[model samples]
Target: MAFHKNLTRVERARLAVTKLICPITRDALRVIPLTDFIFGIYISSRYRYVYIDNPKTGCTSLKSAMAELELRGRKSDLDPLNLEVIHYDSSPLKSFVPIFPKPTLSNLIKNNYRFVTFVRNPYQRLLSCYLNKFDNSTAKDNPQARRMPRGAAPGSFSEFIDAIIGQTDHDMDPHWRSQSINIHYSRVPYAYIGRFENYATDYVTTFHKLGIPADEIPTLRHLNKTGAGRASLHEFYDKKSQDAVYARYQDDFVNFGYPYELPD
Candidate 1:
């Protein structure tokens, strides 16, 4: 991971520590069935809130905001450009595992600590994933590229859909994984479910629900912007691709109340 020369002493120290710990921690967590869910979950003991991360659904922005809140200042703010720092294990926002015991976690869940997550329209999300990973020159290096079916074309939206359609969420990368599986919708009692389409307003509402005062609520910084810019859904989706995405992510459509048909 590249570190910015502009990073402060404390930030550099934190990043160094994160680099040392993440590899060991990730290797240990790999055997657990709940690894994905556990890693995605960020809980704030001070604020009594939990944020479940869903990739490609404004996760970077929301996590940065959460980090700001956790630190109690925007000063020496998180570098939106560097994901490693934002996701550092030393951050005030802690993940579920290695931090809370099962009994303690159960009690927190039973006590109704606010659980929150954001999701995007599957149609848009799939296209975004394709554009960001498969369509880019860096496609060959991405792990997802290796998962593509033998004959599938790199950067072909329809082919990308076909590749993931046959795989279960557990086998798929989180970038294109089903939202329901990523959020563990049935397993966790989410107090607020935000929409990426309506992120600007929904995030503020989420912060309010988390009991953050209006003045103290961290601003949602738009970061890691990817996918063909200003591109329309029609540019990527045709009948086959659209239907396949809808079929694969039907649970997301039904659970999140997103319409099946593309918007004009």
Candidate 2:
């Protein structure tokens, strides 16, 4: 790509890995046993669209809309907002069996289906995860999560970021995991990856890519609110914490077009 000519070596390398790495063979696709742990992947053999849901990036709403799309078809008589998620949940470890036959799962991956997902600014996503999962004084989480100091969120954020930057992708939760790591660029061929920065506008374009008309798409709904009781990303990130986010999730920033520098 001509764009690659202008990118720095590191940026170009991330691009190369994201684009060049994932090339799953038909035989491999055929043998991947469907299970509950395949968290956010939605395969619609009916519409031939495969959606990989990135948690905390409007996944619940997207999955619900997708569930209705699968159940009601492209021209849904049902409302997307009223629809429920039958196949997917945010729990990274839980999985759902494919509605399609075992053999058909292979064809869906190998055939005409468009594979799509949305990504967010990694720093913002990290903040959202902390607020939703750790900042809460009431909710139960991983025993490790309980240890992140509250109130002094920037320090906690910095501490948490440091831990995961050194850890493997699977070792961290999806909310804190690197987007590039989640997608496993080398093995999965995703047809479209949109950014949540331009969510409403980009979503219309994404819906079209999924073979759904813009009119057919519902008014985008907000299902989850990690922001309600907490401060936004801006309030929690100091210069040190900001730099940590940049260093830790730079692949996401470079690949997804987020600014490298944090806002003042």
Q: Report the number of the highest-TM-score candidate.
A: 1
Error of 2 at 176 (Å): 1.0
lDDT of 2 by residue, 1-264 (tens): 112225677644543443333234222223231121145456666667777657678776666666655656344354445433333342211233232223233355666677888888877788777666666535444543633333223236656666666654544556676777665444566777877767778777778888887777756776777772345666677777788778878788887778977533
- Per-residue CA lDDT of model 1 for 1-264, tens digit only, reads 223447567645654454354442233233222445446767787798878778888888888888777766446555534566466554556533422222133456766788899998888887777877767645445666655655344657766777889886666777878888777676667789998889899999899889899999887788877754357889778898888888889999999999989865
Highest lDDT against the true fold, candidate: 1
| lDDT for predicted candidate 1 compared with the true structure | 0.70
Which sections of candidate 2 miss by over 4 Å?
1-37, 73-107, 141-155, 228-232
